[model samples]
Target: MADFDIELDASGLNCPLPVLKARKELNGMKTGQKLRLIATDTGADKDIAAFAKMTSNPLLDFYIDGEKRYFLIEKGAN
Candidate 1:
């Protein structure tokens, strides 16, 4: 399994915050670097997807295990 370059725990944070924090981290990452965000908000499914689309980053993978929503994102070229 590919390890993420950055791991962000957004669990317990609500909508927008997770996506926003992911964006902030993604903004500083180089192209091709991956970020893993773990969120507990049920709404993260939509928020993270839209954030990736809007930011032009690629949503590498998404999964739900127990109460956590795991999202992998690759930073897009500048």
Candidate 2:
């Protein structure tokens, strides 16, 4: 896996918040940068994947540790 350039702890947030904040953060980042997003929202499983696809960002990895979910996403040129 690639090292993340930034980390966003969206743990405790729900649904769109996590994806929204991720989009906001990614907007400020350079292309090819990576984001490590830690979220507890169950909805993130689908939301994050859809958001990545919609924005052209690439989700590099994902895993669950108990209730916590981790997403590794790479910013794309789009």
Clashes of each: 0, 0
Clashing pairs in 1: none
TM-score of each: 0.94, 0.95
Q: Write the per-residue lDDT of candidate 1 for residues 1-78, one digit (tens) a residue.
A: 258999999999997899889988988999999999999999999889998998899899999999998999999987
lDDT at residue 4 of model 2 (Cα atoms): 92
- Per-candidate Cα RMSD to the true structure, in Å, reads 1.0, 1.0
Estimate, for each residue in 1-78, the C-alpha lDDT of model 2 and write its tens digit: 458999999999987899999999999999999999999999999899999988899999999999999999999995
Local distance difference test, each candidate: 0.91, 0.93
Worst 10 residues of 2 by lDDT: 1-10
Model 1: lowest-lDDT 10 consecutive positions: 1-10
Q: What is candidate 2's CA lDDT for residue 21?
A: 98
